[model samples]
Target chain A: MAAAAAERERVPFTFSAAGLDHPHIHSMVQGLLDAGAQLMHIYDENPDQANALRAKFQTGQVVQELSAILHSEVDLVATSIVPSKRGALGVQVLEHDKHFLSAKAPFTTMAQLHAAEDAVRRSGKKWAVFYSERLAVEAALLADGIVQEGLIGELFQLTGSGPHRLQAETRPAWFFDPGKNGGILCDIGSHQIEQLLHYARCKDAKVLHSKVANYAHPQYGDWQDFGDATLVTDTGVSQYFRVDWFTPEGLRVWGDGRTVLHGTNGFVELRKYTDVARSAVGDHLYVVTDEEEIYFPAKGKVGIPYFRQLIDDCVLGTETAMSQEHTFRAAALAIQAQEQAISLTKAGERR
Target chain B: MAAAAAERERVPFTFSAAGLDHPHIHSMVQGLLDAGAQLMHIYDENPDQANALRAKFQTGQVVQELSAILHSEVDLVATSIVPSKRGALGVQVLEHDKHFLSAKAPFTTMAQLHAAEDAVRRSGKKWAVFYSERLAVEAALLADGIVQEGLIGELFQLTGSGPHRLQAETRPAWFFDPGKNGGILCDIGSHQIEQLLHYARCKDAKVLHSKVANYAHPQYGDWQDFGDATLVTDTGVSQYFRVDWFTPEGLRVWGDGRTVLHGTNGFVELRKYTDVARSAVGDHLYVVTDEEEIYFPAKGKVGIPYFRQLIDDCVLGTETAMSQEHTFRAAALAIQAQEQAISLTKAGERR
Candidate 1:
C-alpha cells in the first residue's frame, strides 16, 4: 500500500471510439485502455455494432451519431473505420479540437489526406495512426528499444514481408474496390512503410518503383492480390517490401511476417509471425551483435509502449512519441506508390 | 572398382573456357571438371590469363585467341565475360555449332537477349547459364526435391535475397559500370530470377516493376549498390527479390543468401549462405509440412547435380538438367528488369 502511495500516478486522459469497422479496433481500444485512458463515449452509425463494442469494453457510453463524440470535450478519438470514411472522421475529430488515432492505411486517397492534414494544422491537434504491425506487436516494441540502444549499430537496410489473409468471402463491398481500399500499396504496404520510417529514422522517402497485380482475384477489377515497392529514404537507408493476399490456407497463420535489418556492425531479424517453416510460434528475434549472438522469444513478454507514449503526447501536446510529419509522410508515400504502381500482368500498364 | 571403371569409361564431353575474367569461372570450370567434362582449350584475349587458368586446372591447352576455340572441335564453351560481351559470345558459340554454358546475367540488355533468342532458334545447340543459388546450394536442391515430392504442395509464391559482398577494393573498373556489369538487377538478380523460374516451374516471367540505386557510390555513374524487382510468372506464381552489395564486413561470409518458397500444404525456406544472425553456418533448410517439421543441415551432403545433367545434355542432346526456354526466359526477365529499372534517388527517372 505504501509502495503504491509513493509511486507517481499516471494522469488520466479521456477519449472516445469513432468507427468500429476494421477488426484492429479491438487492439486499438485495448491499447488506449491499457494506457490508463478514460473512455467516455462510443459513436458509430450502426447501434448494434457500437453497443456490442461498448458492452465488451464496458467503459464508454454508446451514442447513435459520430457528432456526439466530436462535440464532446474528449481528449482524443480512437477509430478503425473503413478506409473511405477514415479521413472525414479524422477531420471532424480534429475540427472539434480533439486528437485523432485511426487504423493504418489512414486515407484511401490523396485528397482526403490533404483535408485531414489541413484540419490537423488548423486545430493544432495530434494525428496518429495505428500501425499495428509495429504498434500492436510487442516484438516490434522490443526491437525498437534494442535498435535505439545501439544493439545492432547503424541500421543500413530493412526488408519486410507482409503476407496477409484475404478473407475475401467475409469482406464488405468497399474492400474490393481500388479507390476505396486505395490499392495494395496504400493499404497493406502502409505497415512496412511506417516501420521503414521508424527503423530507418528518415523524415522522407521516395517511391522508386512499385508493382501491383490481381492475378487471382480478377473478378474484382482492380483489387490487387500482390504488391511490392522499393525506396530510398532521406537518411540513405534502403528498403524493399512485398505484400500479398495469397497466404495459403494450410499455413497455420495469417502470414510468415519477418523483418531482416542489416546494420554496419551486424544484423537482426525479427520473425514477427511464423518462424518460416519451423513452429507456428511468433515473436522470435535473432540478433548477431559484435559481442555475442542472441535468440530471444519475445512474444507476450513485451507490452505496447507506443500507446502509452502517444497518450502522453496527446495530453501534453508534445510530438515526442512520433512527429505528425512522419504519420503524414508515411501515408503520402504509400498513396504515391499506389498511384504510380505498374500492373504486373501487362508489364507496361498502370492502374 | 567396377563402378569407378564404368564412370571413367563414360564418353567425355570436351569444352573450352572463353572468359577467364569473373571469379565464378573457377566454380563453373570446377563443376565441369567434376562432371567428367574434359577441358580441351582455354581461350581469352589475354594469353597470360588463359595460361594461368590452364596451369591451375592442370588440364585444357592455352589458346591465343577466342576464335581458336570457336573454330576447334570443342563441344561447348563456358564463358563468364563482362555482361556486355556475353551476348555476342553466346551468338558466336551458337553459330559455331557448340553448346554454351556461361555465368548468370547472360545478357546485359533486353535487345541482346532477344538477339540471343533468335540465335538459339537459328542454331539448335544448347544454351545454359549457371544459376548457382540453386545449382550450387545443397539446401535448394533438397527443397526442389521436397516440393517435387509433394512435401510442400503446389507452390504459389517465392521470396529471395541475393546479398553480395561489395569487395570494392578488389573489383575492376568495369565491374562498377552498369553497361559492363549490367547493374544490380542483371548481375546478382539473375540468380533470384532463375530460382523463381525453376522452383515455380515457370516458363516465362514479366518484369512487373524494378528499382535500382547508387546510394553509396555516387561517383560511379550507373553503378547500383542495391536493386529490387517484382515479377509474375505465366504459371500464376508471384515473386519479389532484393539484391545488394551492402553485406557488412562483420558478416562471416559473402552473403546470407536465402530463398523462401510458399506452397499450399506448407512452406520451405533455404538458408543458402549463413543461417543469418544465428550461426555463420550456411545451407540450413527448415520445412513445415502437414505431417511434420523437418530441419536439414545440407552442406557437403548435396552435390552439384545440374553440372552432370548439363554435360549429358551437351554430349547426348538431352535437357533433363533444365529447359533452354527457361534459361532464356530467366535471363530475359533480368535484362528486362534492368532495362526498366528506375533510380530510387531520382524517383521518376527510369533507365
Candidate 2:
C-alpha cells in the first residue's frame, strides 16, 4: 500500500483543462484520473465553472487565464468547450507541445477540423476524441471484440440510432442554435461516425445523402431536432445513421442509444442505454450468429481501454491509440454532413 | 348472417384482380369482401399463381388474360404486380373505366406516376394505393383517432421505421432486382410516404434527400437492403423515415413496424406490427399527451375501415377512403426519391 501510494505520487504526466463548459468534462476528468493522470491546473473563461470544478475535484488550481495552463508544467489539456470553440482551444493546447483530449465533436465545421488537423500534424502531439458512445459503452467493446474475432464475419454495415430526450428548458440558450451545437449530425452523429470508422475498419467514407429538420421545435427554427445521413466508406462498407431529439418520457435514460452492425454471416445489436422495459441496467448486447443467439448483459466485462492506451501513446509517442487522421476524418465527415444537410420544417418546407 | 351473405352475392359493384402474384392480394381480397364487394375474377401473367388464388379464395374465377378483367363487367380491379409493371397495368385498368386498388408504391417511376395520373384524368376512375401500414395497422387507426380529436394538438412530424426480415430464399428472383423491386424507397418507403401525408394532413410534400444502400447481400448487387429519406409536407410537417431488410431471425414478425407522430402538445408511437421483444401481439399504440400517458392495444378496436370507405367511394363517387391526388403524390414522392437516391455498396463505396 505504501509502495502504491509512492508510485501514485511519482506519476510522470500532469494534465489540466482549458475549457469547462460541457458536462462531459466530469467524465473526461474521471477517465483521465483512472488512467493515472494527475490534475494540476484548470481554467475556463467562466471563473465560477472552473472554481466549482476545482473545489469538487479538490486538486487542480483554478487559473484566471487560459495561458496560465499553457505556461504551467501540465503535459496535456483535457477540454470540452462549445462545439464552435473546441477546435481553436485544441490548436492552442497542441501548439504548446501538449497532448489534447477533446470531448466528442471537437469541431463544428470542417474548417475547424482542418485547422486542428494541421496543428496536430505540426506539433506531433497526441489528439484524441472522447467518443463516449463507443469508448464508454462496454457492449460496444464486446461487440467490437466479437467482430474482431471473426465471430460475426466480415462487417458490411452499421446502423446507429441515438434518440435523446429534449429537456429543452434546462439546456443553455446556445444549445438551440445550429452554429453553436454543430447541428445533429456533427454533435451526436459524430459518435456514430467514429464507431463506423472503428468497427468497419475503414479509413474514409463519403456522405451520400444527409438531412436535418426541426420537426416539433419551430420555436428554435435554426435548431435541428433530427438529422440523418447515409455513408459509404472507401472500402465499400455501407452505413445509415440517425440522431434525434424525440425520445419519450417513458425511457429510463436520456437516450435509447443503440447500434446494429450487420456482417456477411450474422449481426450484433448493442442496446447501449436502457434495454427497453426489460431491465433497469444497460449494456445489453444481442448477438445473432449461425452458431448462437446470445443475450449478454456485459457489465464489468469491458473497461475504458482507449483511455489507458491513449495515455500510453501520449507518453511514448506511439500510434497505438486512435490515429489523428482517423479522428479528423470522422469529425470531418460529420461536420460536412451537417453543413451539407438540407433543412426542412415540420410543415414540409425546405429552408 | 345468411341474409348478409345473400346480399353480398347481389352486391352492385363487382371487383376483380389483375395482378395476383403478391401475398397482399389476400388481404386486399379479404378487405374488399368484408366491404360488401363481390369478387368475380382474377388474372396474372402466371396461370399457376392466379389458379392458386382462385382455389384458395374459392370466390374469384381464374381468367387466362389481363384483358378479360379489363373488358369484363368488373367495377374495380385490385392489383399488386411487379413494381415496374404496376403503373402501366393501373393505367390500363383506369382506361377501361374501372376503379383500381393498387398495392403500395403504385408506380415505380415518376414517368409511370404521370402516366397513371393522365389516365385518371381521361377516365375519371378512382385510383387507390393499399398503404396497409396506416390503413391496416389498428394502432395507427387509434392514434389517428386521437390525432383527429385534437388530443395531440398541432402536428409537427411523422417518423416511421419498417424493418422486414429478408426471407431471401422465399423471395422471387425479381425481388432481388432493383429495376423489378423499384428499389427500397419506392417499395417499402411508399407506406411511410402515405402515412406522412395522412398524419400530417398535407396533400403535397417534397423529398428533401433520399439514400439507398446494399449493406449485406452483395449477391443481389442492384437491390437496396436499406433506404431512407427526409421529407417536408407543405404544411410545415417534417418527416424522417427508414426502410431496411435487416430484421434479424429473433424478431417475431417480418418487421417491427412502428410510426411516431410528434405534435405541439405531445407525441404518439404506434407499434404497427409488433411490440418487438416486449410483447407478442401487434398494434400496440403508445400516446404521450397532456391528459395521460397511456398504452392502448387496439387489436380489435380498429377494423379495416379503409376498405369499407373505399367501397363507398367506388360505387358512390365519393372521396372518403383517400384522395386520388393524395395517393398519387405519395407514390410519386416515393418513386421520385427512389430515382433520385444515390446508391452505395457495403464497403462505403458510392456506386
Candidate 3:
C-alpha cells in the first residue's frame, strides 16, 4: 500500500474528474493524483456534483482550484470525464492529452488504433497506452510472440467469428450502437483478426467473405453479436473463424476456448475464461504436437498487467516486447473482419 | 591395344565397318550386340545386308533372322536401318533403342553401359545395348561422380545445350534433318538434358516459353541451331536455359557436352569432349560457390567407361549412378523446350 501511494505521488500532474461519474474513472483519477499528480482542470455538466466538489476543494488546504493547477504549467496531464449523451469524454480526453502530454496524445479516434501510434511518433516520446476492452490488445501480443519465435514456420491464415445472442439485450442500448463501437464482431472479432495478420507476416490481406447474424433474444433491434468470416491469402492459405455470444455451457467452453493455430509442424490452442470472476482459475495455453501436448498457465485480471511492463520499458529505455506496428495491423484486421462480415451477411440476405 | 583385343575375344562379338555405311543403324546394332544380344528379325525392302550377315553365321550359331526387327518375336532387338534416306542414321538408332528399351520389348535393351545392371536384373544373362561411343558414356560417369558427393545441394535444375554448327559441313546433308535427330539440340542436347535431369531431383517439368533461330548457315534449310527456353515448376521455381549450335567457336558446348545441374546452394558444370581423333582431353567438372571455385582434376583414360560401368553394375547388382527416371524427365523437357522454341520463333516473325 505504501509503495502504491508513493508511485501515485510520483505522477506529478493530473486532470479534472468532476464530470466523470463512473467508478472506474473515479478510481483512475484518484490513483493518478494520489501518486503525486496535480489536478489542473475540473468541470461537471452536473452542477450539483461540480459545486459540491468545488466546495470541498476550497475547504481542504491540500486541494487547489482547477484554475490554479492549470496556471502552474505542469509537465503532464490526465483525466477521466463522463460524457453526456450529446458528447464523448474519451475523444475529449484524447484531444486534451495531445496538448498536455508534450503536444501529443497517445489516444485518438476509436476507429483507428494507429492514431495513437501516429501521435507517439510525432511527440517523439516513449509512450504507453490504455484503451477499450473491445480492442483485446493482449491477444495481439500473443500472436506477436508466436511469429517472432518462428514457431509455426510461417503464418498463412486467420479466421474468426462472434456470438449472436448478446446484442438482443435492450437495457444497455449503447451495446447495439455501431457509432460507439458496439457491433459484436467488430468489437470482439477485431482483436483476433488483427493478431492473425500480424502473426502471418502478411503485409496486406484481402477479405474473402464474412457473415453476421442477430439470433435469439432480439430485443436489441439494431445490434449483431454473432458472425463468421473467411479470408484467403495470395499464397493460397485460407482461414475461417466464427463468434457467437450464445453457447451451451457444456458444449461451448471445451478445448481451450476454441482458439487454435494450425502450423506446418504443429498447433497451439488458447483458452481464457469469458467470465472475469472465474477466469483467473481457468485460463490456459495449450501447445500440442503430433506426439504430445503441453499446457501453460495464465491468470486473468480486469486489465492487462502487461501494460505496466510496457510503461516500465518506456521509462527505462528498454526494448519493447511487441512492436506498435503489429498492434496497428491487428487493429486494422479486426475492423476489416467486422466490415467484411457485415457486407457478406447483407449479400447473403440478397441471395 | 592389348585390352581392346582381349575384350573383343572374350565378348564373342564381331564388328563390320560396313555397318558404318548406315551410321544410325550401325550404332543401334552395335549397341545391342555389344551388350550380348541379337535381333530376332530384320525387315527391309532390300534385306541385302541382313541376308549377308545371316549367311555368315553357321546353322548352330546363336543368331536369328526375321522380316522386321520391330515385329521380331525375339525377346530383345536392335536396328540401324533407315527406310527413307541414306544418312538418317542418328534417329534410326535412337528409335530402335527406344523401342526395344520400352516396357513393350520382349527382351531388354542393353549395352556395356547397362551390362552390370542388366545382369543384376536379368541374372547372368547379357542384356542388349546397340550403341557405340563408349568414351562418351565414360565422361557421363565422371560427371555423376561430382553430383553424388553432394558437391551441390539436392539436384534441383538440370539443362543441356548443343553440338552446334553441324549444317555448315558440305557433306552429310541428313545432319540437318529434324526427323533424323540431325540438329545439334537433338543429337547433343539430348545427352546433356538427360544428364542434368539425372542429377536434379526434379521428376517432371513443363516448358514455360522458348525462342529459336536459324541465324547462321541457312544452307541447312532454315534449320534452327540456336534456341533458348524457360521452364516453370508447379513449386514456383523457374529455370531458364539456352542452347546454340552456331556459337563463335568452331564447336562450342555447355554442360558436359550433355547436361549441367544447378543446385540450391551451389553449381556443377560439366563439359565433355568427344573428338576421338584428338587427345580426347577437355573433360572437366567445376564445382562453384559464391566464395570460390573448385575444379576436380580430369580422370584420364578411365577404362571401358560409362557403358562398361553400366554393364558392371548390371552384373554386380550395383545401383546405376544416374536414374532412368531422371533421364526420361530430361528428355521430355528437352523435347518440350524444342517445340516451344519453334513456336516462339514463328510468333516472333509475325510481330
- Candidate 3 positional error at A105, Å: 17
Ranking by TM-score: 2, 1, 3
Instruction: Report lDDT (CA) for all predictions.
Output: 0.81, 0.81, 0.40
DockQ per model, Cα:
0.26, 0.23, 0.01
> TM-score for each prediction?
0.86, 0.87, 0.36
lDDT of 1: 0.81
Candidate 3 per-residue lDDT over residues B1-351, each given as its tens digit: 345335535653322211222334544444445555433444334456555544543211222333243233333333333212222222232333322221101111122123334332443322332222223445455656666776554444444434333334543444456554434343444444443344444566556545554433345554555555545343322343445552222222211143445443445555555221222355655555423355554556453344334443433435352344443345445555555444222221211
Error of 3 at B164 (Å): 53
Q: Which scores higher on TM-score, 1 or 3?
A: 1
iRMS, all models: 5.5, 4.5, 28.9
Error of 3 at A129 (Å): 5.8
Interface RMSD of 1: 5.5
Model 2, span A168-190: residue lDDT tens: 87788778877888888999999
Rank candidates by lDDT, best first. Answer: 1, 2, 3
- For residues B237-328, write the lDDT of model 1, one tens digit per residue: 77889888767666677887889887656678888888755668888998877665667889888777888888777656678788888888
